[model samples]
Target: MSLPLTAGETRLIVAAADAFFPPDGPIPRSGSEAGCVQWFERYLALSDRRQRLLIRLMLAFVQLAPLLLGPERRRFTRQSAPARIAFLARASKSRIYFLRVVFLSLRAMMTMAYLSDEIVANAIGMKADTDPFGLGGQPPLERMVPPPTPQASGVRLKGGGPAVEPGLGDVG
Candidate 1:
């Protein structure tokens, strides 16, 4: 699949995934080893416009954050593995709520993509396709939607929305 972001964005996300999923514990596969980059690309494509924009902005901010916060002035992807790990560690413990939120959100996004992989999900003993509520088993009913408000009238009817399945909407 064609990646929409710049090369630097791609590398930075890969770097983040590496830091977030280092091979130090119960997890058997590294994020990259689990094909996190491809998963993230699919995640981005399926996101609504606003979600995609927010994720892209988070990636851009995190890519440059090492320069401002790290001991050395370097882009995130250019930093060594230890440096990348330290960067995320510091961001996670940052006193500033905004910094913590940014890094944590990025971490969640990457983790979601990583575990969606078939091998990883099975290794972790998770039934990735379990949708207990059955909400998405069928197409939404015509009468299920409430009357759209004046401001949000067009949002619900948009076609090609996010995947309707319960897991790994990575088919994109």
Candidate 2:
């Protein structure tokens, strides 16, 4: 299935991803070169309508945010790399919680798409750890750390009071 994003929207996504995960050092390629936009398109195609709409709205907001918050009133994709990075830095710390959330969400999406690429993963040695059929020297489940004992920590109720266990606390 095709993504619902427009050409401009797609460009915005690519620009944002490129700014967040620049093709520097170990990256070897820009987010656009690494196929971040295509990854996002595939993700959106599989997502629910509401999720797709939310992501689209976030992209629109990011594209237009530079005009409102930037020193120069330009679209985000039109800005220079440094300018784009500055705009994102400011947006990530905005007093508006929703704006911060949107920035973080976009950053996460871009980072995930970039890092999850087979080339990137292999370069980072993650590909070396995979044993799909458990044929490798995997640790036994019993060697794993046990779950924390709930009783060791004080359990608090939703309203911030300590949880009163039945029969453990004084009852009428």
Candidate 3:
């Protein structure tokens, strides 16, 4: 087996992995298949501040996702394989940001598989057809929905209009 991971490197990798896989979907293969664990390990060892900044940005991006998407977060978290793979294929700066946060989160290493998927998907142009937020041609079900409309009561009884006076209807 390869040498053990350092504490900081392990922390970063785990965090990146957790955000990659939600509760549902196919269980990804090991770190060797993705090669990101190695990438991460090598990356963490470096003293570059840019990586640190990218990681910070990624964490904020992920945390904001919950608020920005709202109810849709549940569905996005359980996305279809195609969508999941598409998101993973791309390894852009955005992916790095995601990876950094997940690493910090200290989630399971298994989750990293999904991140690898996204990086790979992105590189192969899968992201071109799919938007990270599922905005681009994605099915309506996965898209964010407008808040429910407030029901309008035609009887306009605001400001105590005596709609329910003391003996209005068969008081016992």
Candidate 4:
């Protein structure tokens, strides 16, 4: 297994999938599915080997899917969106093409996860409690985690000025 994802990454993916695919709902979800996570794990392993191949596989998958499904007006292939998803999932599970397919699938999942929350949050006009990009302060937790000490937190580290300009010294 690959190194565990950071809590923030997990939170982001979860939130996105929840927003994108409601429980007992029609739309497809990412990372929330048991297989999606497994797909990501497998892909991450492959990425550790050949990163560029990931991109190639994704492009190939998209271009080949429609043709492979044939122009039949069947239930699966009739609708383009879901069919593409199903096809990709199945391909990602293929042992022979597992590396390539997994890479594409994970990349797609991550992309979807990165966007879902923001899109829903915007559609409903709800402001995000935390930055979606995970660049800001931590989201709320059950209990407060203590802040690091000045020394450990890099408060006293010199050779540079404060990260932000100090406002007029409040010393009265």
Candidate 5:
């Protein structure tokens, strides 16, 4: 629900995030429970139309990955916990090059969101607000998706400037 994606897409993303970073032993809070969905919502809210579409396509592919596996046609969101885990493990290590990329991308996204949680970050030695600027309170997506560079009055509003490292560009 937090994600800007469609209902089904949001469900799929939540399911995927939970599967990717499920609780083990003492680590409480699955990825979705740790605010991964909300993280993704902020991220997508800043993405351009094309980027959002590509992300949705990747999510769709991940949702349908079971079909690519075998006769198990159940969508990713509907699968049991164990089955979802197995699918994610297999997809991430898949021999199919693009499948590996897609699955890895999903895993990375979930991991980033999961690590953004203060509890997990502290546990893992990542300071949440160590920065003097209080950047830790800002969504990571804000840096990843900066505001567009200023354009001329009559410009057609083309692409933004080149990609940048986080917090590197000056908005002013």
Candidate 6:
């Protein structure tokens, strides 16, 4: 499905994904080639309006960050691959929590997009054997037990004394 992002925004996402998950080793395609942009588009489409807006804002920041933070003031998409990678690496180490969060979030998305491909999984010897019936072993959710909820106790006052009930004290 078509995403809500503008053309420029879409280009930026593609470029960012490519930079974050460049094709290497046995991998034959970059994140964008593995359909990262399409995955991101679908994800945004499924998200709530607020979430979509926040994701868009994050992408915008990622796209513009190179111009603001890099030694050379250039757009992220226009930067060379090495420059892009360096910018992201620096952002990942930023002292600002928001910058680090944004870098981590983008890295996660890029990794997810790149590694989720069946070809990549098979190439990495991680492809699961297909089971037509419901015989792929029990799902992990079936083994989980809900934890018991803790009961609330009355508040304790200072000095290690039991909490006094209001109006229950001796009146002299």
Tell me each candidate's TM-score: 0.72, 0.72, 0.27, 0.29, 0.69, 0.71
Q: Give the alpha carbon lDDT tens digit for every residue of 90-126 in model 3.
A: 3222345755455344333343444446655564454
Q: Residues 1-172, candidate 6, lDDT per residue (tens digit)?
A: 3356688787887888777767673577677778877778778888888888888888889888877776868998888888888888889899879899999998887787777777777767776657655556767686465568563354446687666555556374
lDDT of 2 by residue, 1-172 (tens): 5466799988898888789878784567778877888888888999988988898889999999889876968999999988999989988889989889989999999988887788877777665446666656646674466767675334556576667655555566
| TM-score result, candidate 3 | 0.27
Overall local distance difference test of candidate 2: 0.82
Task: Write the residue-wise lDDT of candidate 1 on 1-172 in tens digits.
Answer: 3348778777987788878887664788888788878877888888888888898889998989888887868988989989998988899999989899998899888888788878888887988456676666655684487667573322433376633443434365
Of 3 and 6, the candidate ranking higher by TM-score: 6
Query: Which stretches of candidate 5 lie above 4 Å from their native place?
Result: 1-3, 24-26, 128-172
Candidate 5 on 33-62: residue-level lDDT in tens?
A: 788878888888888888888888898898
Clashes of each: 0, 0, 18, 0, 0, 0
**Which candidate, 5 or 6, would have the higher TM-score against the true structure?**
6
How high a TM-score does candidate 2 get? 0.72
Residue runs of model 3 more than 4 Å from their true location after superposition = 1-32, 63-66, 74-172
> What do the candidate models score in CA lDDT, each in turn?
0.80, 0.82, 0.46, 0.46, 0.78, 0.78
Cα RMSD for candidates in order:
14.1, 7.5, 16.8, 17.4, 12.3, 8.4
lDDT of 6 at 18: 74
Worst 10 residues of 3 by lDDT: 84-93
Model 4, range 74-135, lDDT digits (tens) per residue? 33323445554554455556565644554466456765443344544464465755566554
On TM-score, who's better, 1 or 5?
Answer: 1
TM-score of 6: 0.71
Ranking according to lDDT, highest score first: 2, 1, 6, 5, 4, 3
